[model samples]
Target: MMNKTNKILIQWLSWPIHVRIALIVILLILFFGELISVIEPKEFPTAFDGIWWAIVTVSTVGFGDSTPKTHAGKLVGMVTILIGASFAASYFAILSAATFQKQQAYVDGEIPFKRKNHVVIIGWNEKAHEMIQSLRAVKPFKQIVLIDHSLKEAPLMENVHFIRGNPTNDFTLLKANVKEADAAIITADQHKNELDADMQSVLVLLALKGINPSLYCVIEILTEHQANNAKRAGADEIIKTYQLTSHFIMSSYLAKNGLSTIYSKLNPATGNSFQVLPVPENLVGKTFKEASIHLLDQESILLGIKREEEAKMNPPLSYEILAGDYLIVFSH
Candidate 1:
């Protein structure tokens, strides 16, 4: 009979997590209430008063409104104080740990099977961080999943999900929900040599496309030659980082050392932000000068139009706007 009861107790303990917690909590309250009621029957004239005192003690409220008066009752209260403190603290600690465990699971990339239409950024670096910051400024609510191996803890930031693993692994991409991602960005490793980093980006791009052929993917190529490789790996856009920066930096000398001003003016974070909005349908067939004139009323200065494959900057006044073209405007 003892062995059968022992087996039953083990089975009860092995129940599901919520059930176990419920059972433990219920036991904590009931056993303490029954102990106090039996110790001093007058203090707790009824079971309800016993339960009430137990709840007040265990919750750390200690209202002292219905506390015991007799010596045995006081001893029971002292026992409640000792055990209740630990139970009360452990109760909250368990709750906090459970919440933290869920967050840690997300960091380990264990429970992102439902993440869809979110941005997947592979390879965290300076540029990748800047991209994330820019994204936050532009779209405060956009979901961005950061995949990296070096981070020990998930970034404690809102709208940012963390996945810790090798960026080139298809399994890691799967954990990031690449198959349903809205877009994917691959940044080269700033710590490695340019050639090695660019090749790594290419490899990551290949894995991304392999998992989701239709997912829009943009990759950074540190070396000019690796741009071709990245493109061949099915990258929708290959950003030649060194090449673009070098040209842009050199071009600024033409403005008499106005590089800082030029960069600030072009960057959205510095107040002189550039934005691309859909051109009004009524202005589709209108000339650039006419569109600019009308756009002045909206407090936006038309800089150019983004047509198929490229942007036309400072085009002739007679240039006709095409349908489906985006207007590049400057907003202060």
Candidate 2:
């Protein structure tokens, strides 16, 4: 049934200009024709007869079977024919103008700011694309907004929206509804120089924080030096792309075949990825060993505790779980 409706719609849309105009004219004629029929039912006996007379009068066909006898019926027929002729002539012109408006809407970009509890990602690059793809995997149910001036249209993704404008601009940011987003990821500009791009990201961070002071924002910087500045600018978390990998690579090179590959597999995008779970209220005071055993029993491996302001990896078995602590677990 849906396919048949779709086919009919497609056929109607694909009809030539003259055909569409004529169809609309016929519909308008029928409407006024029915109204006239109701106003003077005795003159035009049936509704179909009124419609037939209206069509013939409009088209100059002059079929004698249903001619109007009274002055009122003649007036109705004359007005219907005039309206039908004027509408048919102007119909195609209005259609082309509306088509142009729709095309321009695409070029200008559209962002539905009503979207709430979604992730806003600023900037587009290899890393940003990877982040979006990874987000689709890990956070499939969540909406993602892409803000960039370069993109002409939205990326072909089900849960993603594209806002074509500068990320730092308040108009663009507001269009993405950044203030209401669950979280935001600000990435550096690859098109510009390294330091300049980092500065732009810092400026954007300040703008976002200015709008919503409590918003959780994760920022990407080129160098380790900018991490502190980004934090000062109101970044909740900062990822130093170059510096982070160097330390891991050095550790792997210095030590024997160690945990680098394990870390590589820890991407949240994959099915078997590291996840953070809250300390259960019932087991808030449980020992690390007890928590580990409980989680292991549930087929998840307990890795460590992310306590307030600290990360305790492989804590002593007797270490008690704190109330505000987060359990880092690896799930398959």
Candidate 3:
């Protein structure tokens, strides 16, 4: 019998601290309730009445309807108050501390993301910040994860999880749950020179693809020479930042209202923007002219066709649209 009792005690000690504290409080209440009933049999007629008085006394909610009539019962009430109040205070204090610690860990970017199908953005910059804001505006509930090595605290944003670590590191990518992510955008690191930044972006792409070969990656390349390298490293789309900027600058210099027209058309907030859609079943096996006419009827203009990985702008009217082809249309 003694050995069985010792084994039970050891198991109880192994329980969580909060569970132990809770059990002790309950046992004290039951013990004092039974003691008070025996001491003042007339005052607490039923066992339930004794338990009620004990609860009221411990909580300091004395209703005065039930009270200890004898000196012994009053002494027992005092003991219940002291012990119960202490345990209650300890439980609440521990609960508050735990909640605060969890919040602190999240702000410090120490929490690992567990959700799937989120968009991962690598490197923090003005471009990334703008992209996040734009994505939030378009899809308010889209999940986004930001990975950066230099940040000391996560950015305060809804639906955005932050992982503070080197983007090129495999562990960091895993922490962001990149293996299950839908897509990733690797922005050029602003702190490095043009060539070095491109190289770093390519390295991050390689790490991301190594973990999830099916992950769609869009990377920004500053130098023209590194564009091919980024593509070879498993980047689905490459954004040539310098070349795009140069085209816009030259256009603005040549035309009086070049950017104004282009910006207005590109802005989705203006109720019209470019949209990539799958080729409709009816459009398959049809000529480009027929596809353009069909899109025109729907208040859209067919700009180009994306076949597999290659995109052709304004293909010849006789060009045939095949199944699995995507259409790039300017829609209203």
What is the alpha-carbon lDDT of model 2 when measured against the actual structure? 0.82
C-alpha TM-score for every candidate: 0.74, 0.72, 0.84
Query: For this target, which candidate reaches the highest lDDT against the unseen true structure?
Result: 3
List the candidates ranked by TM-score, beginning with the highest.
Answer: 3, 1, 2
lDDT of 3: 0.89
Candidate 3: how large is its RMSD? 3.3
Question: Candidate 1 vs candidate 3: which has greater lDDT?
Answer: 3
TM-score of 1: 0.74
lDDT by residue for model 3 over 1-332, one digit each (tens)? 99999999999999877778877877777888888999999998878888888778776778989888788988998898899868867877777887798788888887999999999999989988888977787777889999998889899989999998998889899999999999999999999999999999999999999999999999999998999999889889899999988988888888877565676456564567788899999999999999999989999999999998899999999999999999999996
**lDDT against the true structure, each candidate:** 0.82, 0.82, 0.89
TM-score result, candidate 2: 0.72
Off by over 4 Å in 2: 1-31, 34-100, 107-112, 251-264
Q: Over the stretch 241-314, how does candidate 2's per-residue lDDT look in tens digits?
A: 77877878888888768768777576777677777778889779999999999989889999899988687899
**Candidate 1 lDDT over residue span 141-252, tens digit each:** 8899999887776776678888888988877888888888999988888779999988888888888888889999998887878988877788898888898888887787
For TM-score, candidate 1 versus 2, the one ahead is 1
